[model samples]
Target chain A: MFRILKKSLKTGVATGRHPQATQSSEPLTPEAHKKASAFNRSLAIREVDTGSCNACEVEMNALTNPVYDAERFGIHIAASPRHADALVVTGPVTVNMARALKDVYKQTPDPKLVIALGDCAIDCGAFKGSYAVTGPVDRHIPVDVRIPGCPPRPADILKALTDIQERP
Target chain B: MAETKSCDTELKTAFPSIVQRDTTQREFSHFFVAKDLLPTIARHLHTQPGLHGRLALLWAVDNRPARNTYELHYLFTLEPSHRWVLLSTELAKDDRVFPSITPHIHAAQWYEREIRDMFGLIPQGHPDLRRLVRHEHWPQGAHPLKKDFPWDRALGRQQGEHRFHRIEGEGVFEVPVGPIHAGIIEPGHFRFSVAGEPIMQLELHHFWTHRGVEKLFEQQPLAAAVPLAERVSGDTTFGHSLAYCQAVESLRHLDVPRRGRYLRSLFLELERLHNHLGDVGAICNDTAYALPHAHCSRMKEQIMQLNDRLTGSRFLRGLNRVGGVALDLTAAQLAEIAAEIDRMEQDFSELESIIAHNASLIDRLEATGVLTERTAWDHAVVGVVGRASGLDQDLRRDRPFAAYDELSVKVVHYRYGDVRARMRVRMDEIHESMRLIREIRLRIPQGPVAVESSPRAQAGEWALSAVEGWRGEILYMVMAGDNETIQRCKVRDPSFVNWPAIQWAVIGNIIPDFPLINKSFNLSYAGNDL
Candidate 1:
């Protein structure tokens, strides 16, 4: 128990300043940056993996760790879509998961934002042209933000989440 | 390298009439059997003491235009000798029906169902021929893996409920979990038949995310297919890609450089480290212990950052090419990695001690979700789950690919196949992996990371590559096409075999302990579904 306390002290403060700082770091216009910070202050996210390779899920999960501490910014991953203010979907929308993706979109309350969170979700990425893939998330539901990487870094994911303003 | 056991002479002497041609390669033996005698040979190879064969993978290839038939391949790894024997038989396309080996082998259940779903090959005697890969909405006779099917074709959604086997009893209620879960996990439906809190049976419905990974490999050039292989399972990026690269390298007969082998092993161990750390944490999280989970996540993040610094990608993506690794590690980077691993080891040991002293955590973990050794062998479970159940197998030590041929690997196993046993196996493996990474860093050869050898299109040639990935043995079978492209690429992720074992593990466990038990195995849904 003493060792735990000592270790905790040595760890120090590991949380990062989110929304305001992450949004400001983005090369966005000041007006847009302000809008993003205002909108993302107390965001509740629901992560939906349509047909991912799971790299995106790892990075997303990291956001909650001590390093990123997404919870510090009120960016909690909700357990249900009904409570989610935003749906962060990953992977290329697969054929079998298409109905579930759409159902998740419908379950989210009106004025909810959908963020496409990988190369696969954005443009079918590495999984493109496969018969099982149903293309990008936008093909199934309207995506407000697109974070592109095979899997975007955790910091990049935070930027994408905080930079969200409205449905594009 | 290990001595080549002449499985050819032994097999030919045993079954002369059935074995048409038996050719032995460096790692495995390819045997061409008569179509009608496939089941007979499979049963014999499995049961006979001389060749105690364990069915590793069962897949079917759509051989059109050249042969006008479908070829079924049954890959088995023989015990004692540890030699692989690939038994293949061709079925005429007009009557593409073969006797199922599931009744005899038992592990061939899902594989036979998958062959029927993907290639339209009818496994005649399969006990349950429910659609495995092709979703229920897929129209009859619309097999995705056939050569004639368009790569980008889409079939509109079909309406109807697929039948799930339910237990009929008074007060036995059914609880259906999801294709879309509440947590940040992949899509897989779990239907549980429970008498109050104890689960009587658990049926899994996977392949919701099957993106035609093999079919996608068909469209790309051999070099371009590395990315697809890496994405097969996101967490297993390096392992899958390395296996794919090894398959191509073997087919081309290109010898990788010493440094390349060392680097590949280094990256593979790093991948194992991060995943095992995260898994250990996640398992604790499931048991409602947040302290160990937090520390493990912190340590995992530290490794992830180290990976990002070593390779360009955090998951070590885009680092494996055809002949060897894409990027070369500098001397300074190697030194830094050594130091980081030392620090990680210290932090990990501290966390392990904390968990060790906690009696409540032990109470929750001990004997929860016990998968007996017999059950594990019946399902042919691989990786840590198999090791925990006393199925003494580790491809790194047995097969020895990459720099593992040179380095000594300490294979960890436990007789008790419970959640605690699995956790112990992982903890031991983490220490072993750390030792390996340190050794590789110390003795890494000074040479080029890759060989300048262009892979040509070789028709009718096939190669198999098996790597001991963090989850288990990740096997890749690649066949060359007539047009300098891949004819077929069969990937058997360890999760493919381990998922069925989870059903048996959860038979007596309560509903609340399900998550803790599931996380102990931590089988990949995307890997299994694909």
Candidate 2:
């Protein structure tokens, strides 16, 4: 109790998880892609950083912040994996992460999309040809889409997910 | 860069079985060692109070002959002395048995097990030692991390695939989470056996995206390998690149210009601030606390925005080269960023206050998932997680590398070792970071950001460079080859030791709080995945 008070007094910042904020919408395009998103639209996403450089993962979290305000699109990060639809993966696939990635991918109901966000997931990028990386998506399991960048800018990722609503 | 002689002295004292001293470079020296003394030396060094940098990472480099030699590299850090000691132990093809350091350090248990399962190096005494980062059913023989391991092996014969282990019991039901999941998440699995909500055994199975960075890096020269090293952990691009660059600089006897060093420090701190902010939000979200999560994340995004405005890449990716940072902040831009950070700091201060003002938040976070000071010291964890538990092991201040000598970093250490303590440490560090950014902004040095670096590295030369990353100390050992590719490149992330402590921290906590506890650690799985 006392320590928390001391810390709060020092930094004057406590990481509280919620505030009274409602959802709003914004599209990368001037108009919505398909009137309705195919990606379990309106679904909340909880991200698992099974093993990522956080390059791609950061973008996912960025979706919620006011800049992008993915909540405006009615999308939120669910606390549990059971509530998410699109599993966004980053980093060159590492050996240790294979099983966990697969397990998460499988649990998401049939109509799910796995977005391999970043160069490492697309073709292992520069880290390819290593004895450790087994990712770049498409290798271990099926990847619906690949967002290529050493790390895609948050705007690029925002565009990629919004673009999904346009795809048949 | 030429090899230095300090490496020779270490190989001699730490591992006397070193048969050959290969010190051709003026920066660092390498030694070919006998296999017998590897574990014993590791045990000796763990107890050595002075020979610091407590074995940060333990992994093997594959020398792919018909009789493959799995070489285990243990990277250590000695406090107050910014020196890194990397010791290697090689095992023959059929003989992979080596004693585990888990008995002494407890932290090496996971690292040794990972080496065992990934590269086929066996650590005999590792308790709970099983295949980590590999599927349970992954075949025993075809270790993926070995040099001889081919990229197309899965097409030829399934090596270490679909090999996740299963727990067997009656009445105790098993719930298996995925290698993929319902979330916008990465690949990994968790097998939980529970009678009720209480989880009896939580076995985390990973290894979906194993690109084999260590072997692939060995195939390239240090100069060409810069791109691969940057991708080792995407969020840590700058951190990994800086560590690698430092190691090469150490070996080549190259000095990154003073301005270059300052820019590198700026970028590293930016990376730390960004990641720490995300974690603060993440841990709160795990507790179902929405307001703080939103605030913390917004603060994190602001940093990313600052990074984009300053460095042109939000994650600070592609901004690190061999010699120094690829992105340089101009006088105007640095000032603007410093101003922006000042604004962000104010918001951070306000948001963090709101969370701290809440009684329920502190009640849940304090004393929950406590890692006692003694256990933390014994494991020798680095960074804030360790610092939160009363271990004063900050590499920047203790070792005084780079601009750390010019700057003051009073690490805010706490003895409580709980989620609250961890968050407190993060808050303290962010304030510390805000001060740093402001100071650096005011004291911006005028010069080129990165100098041209491409020294003709010899095969025999090696160097050790250690830096304090957000998560903790990241050590790199680079052995330059004649052709410019790395003969040996080993990177040790702080998470290697910290992750195991997560298991211990989660020991008595209910499953629901696991996410909150885990988030406080905020370790990079990809950093450890390789």
| TM-scores of chain A in all candidate models | 0.83, 0.70
Residue by residue across B148-229, what tens digits does model 2's lDDT show? 5674455222444444345467777777766555444445566666666766666666545555656666677676666667
TM-score of each: 0.96, 0.82
- Per-residue lDDT over B148-232 for candidate 1, one digit per residue giving the tens place of the 0 to 100 score: 9998887666665678997998999999998878789888999999998999999998899988888888887777789889999
Q: Which structure among the candidates has the greatest lDDT?
A: 1
Counting clashing residue pairs in each candidate, in order, gives 0, 93
**Collision count of model 2:** 93
* Model 2: residues with Cα > 4 Å off, grouped in runs: A1-52, A76-116, A120-124, A127-146, A163-168, B1-41, B48-53, B59-73, B78-96, B155-178, B181-183, B191-201
RMSD of each: 2.7, 6.1
Error of 1 at B286 (Å): 0.6
Q: What are the DockQ scores of the candidates, in order?
A: 0.68, 0.35
